[model samples]
Target: MRVKDFIWLSGLLTVISLPLSAAENDWPVYGGDNLHQRHSKLTQINKSNVTGLIEAWEFDTGVNDTFQATPVVQDGVMYVSLPFNDVIALDAATGKQLWRYQHDLDKDYPICCGSANRGVAVSNGMVFTGTIDARLIALDAKTGKKRWDHRVIGENTGISEDASKLEDTELGSVSGTSGAGINMAPMIYQDTVIIGITGVGYGLHLDAVDSDSPLGTVVGIAGKYGRRGFMAGYDIHTGEQKWQFDTIKSENWEGNFVTKTADGVELPRNITNEKAALQENADAWRYGGASAWSTPVIDPYTGILHFGTGNPSPQMEGSSRPGDNLYSSSLLALDASSGDYRWHYQQVPHDLWGYDVASPPVLFDITIRGQPVPAIGQAGKTGWFYVHDRRNGNFLYKSEAFVPQKNMFSLPSAEGTIIYPGVMGGANWSPVSVDARRRLVFIPGIHWPVEYKLHQQAASEGKDAVRYSSMSPINTPEKHGLLTAIDLDSGKIVWQVKTENPLIGGVLSTASGLVFTGEGSGELMAFDADSGEKRWSGKTDAGVNAPPITYRIDGKQYIAVAVGGNRLFGFKTGQKIKVWRLP
Candidate 1:
């Protein structure tokens, strides 16, 4: 064979061998594998016997806070993270604690928002977790003792300078991302542990003024507040920072100030004013706030990692920062070995709305325009599931709207503009699961509408000009959750199921022709993957706001999830990791 042909053959073999060597028994990675399919090959708990599945075991992590962890199972041990960054390893078959690692946060630490931890990553006998205090720690898998700890970000003041006196101002809750932390499950690839930061886009969140007023606003202050968010790779063995990729583009951060998106969607932007402001705020990228809130997926064969970026700094306020904030609110591909950018597809340029590409990207092969292509898909806060060419970041097609859409790109007005799928998005940081066999992707969505109204800072004794701003919220008649199944070939919704509350965690699919997800009301339901028919469900004590994972140990298939409620959403909270199996 020719030299080029030999090299091509070797690359193809490496990609194909991954699935064969992965073995369907363990869920070793965050999305179950490099593909982020979140689909398992275990069929012992098939749809036919799904109704017979019952709670097999339950373990309390000893903390009653927002538990959003998806447990990682390997061998017979299940490694999970709890509130406050604590971790525990339990026996997969029986809920017996093997070891526990307790993390103590600094008393003066400033947490930007809730204390929910997404999950943990286990690799080469070490367990990794990112803390709410902005630190990455490694612990021995067997004994749960601290191996090493590294401070990922600087001390977060949790409040900005200008908003310091507004702490007691009944106007709204202003949060600072000064020392923002991590909420995503650290990803392990090759010899590195990859993770990102959160809370960089600091803003004010106001609860509905009162019970009579359910439409509160989120105010975005324009001046510098948080630092530029980044994703970094670390040496898995020694806890050393290897490389880092800042989400916000510093150089050429200001683009052409285009009036529309690359996909041809018109934007509500004042181009002339923005262009003039660019020269004065040229250094805005230094404190740009596009956080890395979701875990990244790596394409093992090509060594490319795919992940989403958060909203830009001073989210909702575009007065200070100008130009298309290059990397925020976009899908990015990076070299796995070196944290170098490969390509980026910005969903919303100069994002004034908090429309973060928060959901993790899922990779799968799809037949686009009658041609099979490697693709990456992300369900956006904009209420669309976008598919793109994995190699070059080209927009292929987008799925139909899964949630309601009204006043989509409308700027916040003094009268409170109503918008669907507001700040929370049709899909939030919740992960999307893909079933390559059926060419269908499952999305857990929220249908909340927001009342976006701008509030102006009055010209006081020293200030001459009054600044105008608006807060975001859903101004809907009813709030609900949507579990949607979208067909890749048609970009159409196969079927959708609505629930009582907005879905927060994520979805899980199995080879047994089933898809499982949790609801804020504490019900874990299984549905027919193809038809979206509900098969069975069991109610937990608290909200099941986390992803579910299925793994086999001793030839028995088991499903597990964290059952603590979400604080931001006001769900009932607990401290339980519940596992179910067929009786």
Candidate 2:
């Protein structure tokens, strides 16, 4: 925290706290009403009329870079975060730029392969966004004027004035560490805005061959190099700190050292070796790398918030940090007001592979054995859609793998080992859409494989002599995407449509029996929500690599998405937001 933030907090403590509120019909929340469903009830552009849907308007932000924001539509205006955490307000029907806020970034701001901001949150007459420099800013909804700015994370890692001169710069990706940044859109609940930090975990990234190829090799270095990650809530009115929940468990983080997952999936581990190493390294949890990157879903009735956690520290190699890393790679249930932990379900205990619970959790009601039960669903890097009891974090069942799964839990070898649904995941940070009325969930999937190989070497002549091992990737590979519809009751796939490139963005399903999503190939597509048939597509100048949103203004329905492509995933980059309607 900075001195200015402390002064702001001190002033906020003198004011009274009031509850926040949200708009029902507009796309105000990140996942549309805090359920994280990404589904809309508008039916103007139905299945029968979707074929005639055409471009209504387009706005280019003039920056040819990664744009992954989901526009927040309220009243008649659309608020979106452009590349580099910039913001713009446009007329929903005409795409006329009403206001634009140029984010002034620090010259030495810590960043990585690309600048990607998911979106923004609009609540209580204000628009809020988290920046790439790990700061949160609030703006007046009507005027786009800055209200208050606060540093969300500590500034120990990259605050030095002369940090650029270091070869392996502190908080730089080349040094096996990254600075805290807000890649997730803030979730504004009643009177409190919730947000999390990412890039706390260390992984090597290689250059992709082209725009259509899969991501380059992900190298996981084995050592202590990352800081702990957290999610916190702030006062919507005064910008005061409310409460925070740390992702990494500090005390008793090495829980039970369970050899298999709670559901009895066998994990490849040497328990004896892990138990022996635990005594010497009991404090490793202080630097665990369980970053909370995705936005959270809240049950408005009970105020119970549900979200997923990222991979454990020293990601791929787990020799130094022993025991089951509690809370990492799991689904968490917490009290929305107090930030108290209620329950957790770990997906991979002692995770040696980079399998994270990367997608946002979706809340819906499901019939269990003949009765209605509240359920939470999440798509994993492990290639399955896991359904659980929303209140208790109990696993109900897992759907059939959406993407192909091979050598899922295999150990990395001296000779390379092929692993399907690699670090990017069967669904990576992409929000799934659910039509509760139809009992169907729409998932965007990827089929990118990684060749995990281990490299062992002798100590070098100059540096510290620590016997370390690294996991590296093999070669450049081709990939594809899948749009899958699954039956919520049977946990089975109803239909799947394959695309040319891996689907790295998200899906949106509407009451009109239509599904809309984007691709790395620069195509914004619409499909028959029931049969998985392509109904319409509009080619763009760049990849449509962001979630599409739908809202109604003046009796007209419009679908909008950020067409600015993704750079890390080998997608052509640009800065364009395109909207469509029946023309």
Candidate 3:
């Protein structure tokens, strides 16, 4: 059956747009609206005229690092955060610099990923950002001057004594070990700015040897090397923290120890061993790792905030942190006002495969079993698009696998077990876009097979023996990208398109029926939102590995994206923000 047959959209679009506050012509929030739909209502640049788009202007940030920020525009001014947490305001129409605030970094700090700030939040004449050194700062939107700054990671905040001691030992000398920091953009609700920390899921991440290739290997060292992850709310004007929610709960961190996923897919887990180790590791939550990797989408009417979490500590090795690892590798909902827990759905129970709910959640309304249901959808690294009822966290259905899947939950072996949709994900940190009118969700996905291998190093010459596991992309099956559109009502794939390289950026959909996304190959392409037809393509000097946003200034609509190549994925680095409009 056709997608439109299953999805009745005549009256549903009006209900979905009631609670969103973003203007029809302005890109106000990071995901285009509070729903995080990434869908614009403007149709000035529709599919028929998309091919006539020409470069309106281009601005250089002067810093060449991994640029992954989605530019936020309001009142003809654009606020964007660059690499190293530098925030800049630009004239939206002409791409002229208005004011720039340079963030000074500490000489030494901990960073799990490369230097990249996703974007900034603007509210009540102020711009807010979370720094790489774990600091949250607010700036004057007009003058670009600092208003207030708050240290997010306080002394012994997320740290444990045993984990700190491990950092001082010889084990800390291992390459690719990371520390705490924040890379996601801040989300502003009514009077509070919400942000989260990342890299707490400690693992050894070695980059590819070749500059033009994918990542080399991710080694999971078996020890307590990471701290707990959290999301907090701060006062907009004073930068005073209002409330904080730690991802891992201390007392009941050991969950039900389910041997399968919430969807009844049997996971390759040693449940008996996990239950046996539960009491011994009762205090494991102190160093538990469940990093918050993406900005959350809030339901204004219900006052509920929904977000996703990363992998557990000791990443690929699950022996150290046993049980279901409550809240990690799951989709969580909390009260927006109080930060109180609402409900959670663990996608991967006892996760040892590095399958994080890394992508941001998109909220919409869907028809399930002929009844209208308010729903939330998230693209998972496990290669499926999961849909659930937003009110109570009930599993509605999962879309067909967008990428190939083989031995999905297999354990790593000394001889190496190959798994598709591996660590890099069926979908990574890229945010998905939703078309509420059509009941379709667009996702940017990666298809790379990884070889999971276990290793043991013998004790020698004052060094203790260690066991570690590595996940490296294998050469077989060739890596590529998959841009898919799934029908929300039927949980079926409507259209799929393949690209030459793996996709790491986010997607944008417009009311004019055009879907826009960038590629690591330095091309910005537009597709027909319903049929997946190629509409247009443009080239840039660097890889367009960032989410695209659209806005209207005076009378014309413009599409903008950052053109900084991702360093870890071997894309060519750049420092340009390219804007285009119909000529």
Candidate 4:
């Protein structure tokens, strides 16, 4: 098919496949939309049909780990991602592999975090995703042939000054890795694909650099071509650079900007470039806090793009960059066209602890406080759920429950003073589901009190700071975790199921009004989306780290998940993706 014709047909199919209010037959993109709600309005597989649902077929991408991907469906094509950073597009109806694409990995698996990819994006005839090695590639939707690829991280792009300086005839020297290649899928909007990055070098225990850790980075790309990060964009049909937005220097930072290293090296400012969208908002590029880690959602009506900024680097400590780190770990509402900050809400101000607001924010209209309002919710690593009015980021009657934390981010919380609902949070990458009709945000929340310590990060000479990062206690006195159902509007607890570990996998909501999640003991559970009562449960090999996705082929509903041994939770390399039918 011609490019123009393909796009036209694809768009029409997208609209038609949308099951009016909700459809059971189609599962597309991560979280089911730019909104990432992960909810299906289709109720055919309800608490009843769900029992009769059978697994018709299963295709293993043979990924070594990270089943975090939610398959993207387009015109009966199912695109799924797996651990080891690979993507496969399959025939949605028969599970027949249509095409498989793999990125040549450099194999520097950052041990602290697993080398697993979240998933990919499909829009305008392209399949897009990032690599653990940091390349953002765009592939042909039908052929899986690499159309183009961009290196976002490795040594230096624009963000960090590298150990080796490149005297760019004009710009002089640029540092950091070649650029931290992408591990997550780029957010695909109409013509632009927005992406974020991760670096493993910010903090270290000196257990000696393990076999895994590599540098981290974030990127943005175009839909058609992988023009590269910074302000890279191209025509949706032709891989041509249309614009760029590069970071500005420190002197240009609008607000107080401070970046600290583990060894404590003070870096220079940036120069504005037309490639990135930050030239106009150059200061935004400089200021600290809340670096974006999760894919963003767009307000289809208002053109406001919502993304969660990651925790300030140097994971644990936050003594260096103070004040409400403008955008770090905050929900940044920006004008989609210009990348202008609309409004901001800092979940953890001057975040000393490693509280990255990296979870995808779910955008949906909800009735809150007895009034229906458009809302956006961010699930924090600190185990707190902050639901806000998407229009202005106003707090929607705190969803926090009394919990415990010890001197987190340097704030002395009196045990249960400001207890968060769950430490891993109301939602993590395991996407949350909301049934608009039911008016509830179905979340499999984590319950635990995360403790912190001052880990000193030093490179060679005096490059160090009082940075803060948090880790689950190796051996502690207190331990807790829980799964919760929340009313998006009133912020009331609909129901909560207690878990044995620090909140295992994610939750899946179906139009059939069922909420599915796994436990530490490796069980896939289904419950009434409205009441949170268990209807059925199935066991897996190990705890599920990834969430479950449901799709229908030949009119049969099959739920899929990744079961693996996560090092943090003491699960070995037991990684396997599993699909389930009602039986």
Candidates 1 and 4, the one with greater lDDT: 1
CA deviation > 4 Å runs, candidate 4: 1-24, 49-54, 107-113, 157-179, 206-235, 238-289, 368-371, 402-427, 454-472, 475-480, 572-575
Name the candidate, 3 or 4, with the larger lDDT value: 3
As for candidate 2, its clashing pairs are 20-190, 20-191
Clashes of 1: 12
lDDT by residue (tens digit), candidate 4, 1-583: 7553442232432432233333346666667754677776655567766656555566656655545666676677778776766778887767788888876776553322457677788887888877666667789889889888776544533333222211121212222232244555566556877666554213332222221321111111111111112323344454444443322113432333333311132322221222233443333333232334566777655777777755553333333332333455567777666666578776654344455666778876655344456678876665556778787887765564423333333432223222243234435555566666566776665545443322233343444322222233332334445667777666777787665655545667876788887765666678877676778776666666667777766655677766664444444334555676654
The sequence of per-residue lDDT tens digits that candidate 2 reaches over residues 74-109 is 888899998788889999889999998889986586
lDDT of 4: 0.55
Q: CA lDDT, every prediction?
A: 0.83, 0.79, 0.85, 0.55
lDDT of 1 by residue, 323-391 (tens): 898898999999988999999999999998889999999887766555556778999999999999888
Q: What lDDT is reached at residue 130 by model 3?
A: 94
Better of 1 and 3 by lDDT: 3
User: lDDT of candidate 3?
Assistant: 0.85
- Candidate 3 residues lying further than 4 Å off, grouped into runs, are 1-13, 18-22, 156-173, 206-214, 475-477
Q: Judged by TM-score relative to the true structure, which candidate is superior, 2 or 3?
A: 3
Residues 296-366, candidate 3: write the lDDT tens digits.
Answer: 88886677999999998868888878888988999999998889999999999767888989999999887
After superposition of all CA atoms, the RMSD between model 2 and the true structure is 7.8
Off by over 4 Å in 1: 1-20, 155-160, 164-177, 207-216, 463-465, 475-477
What TM-score number comes out for model 4? 0.75
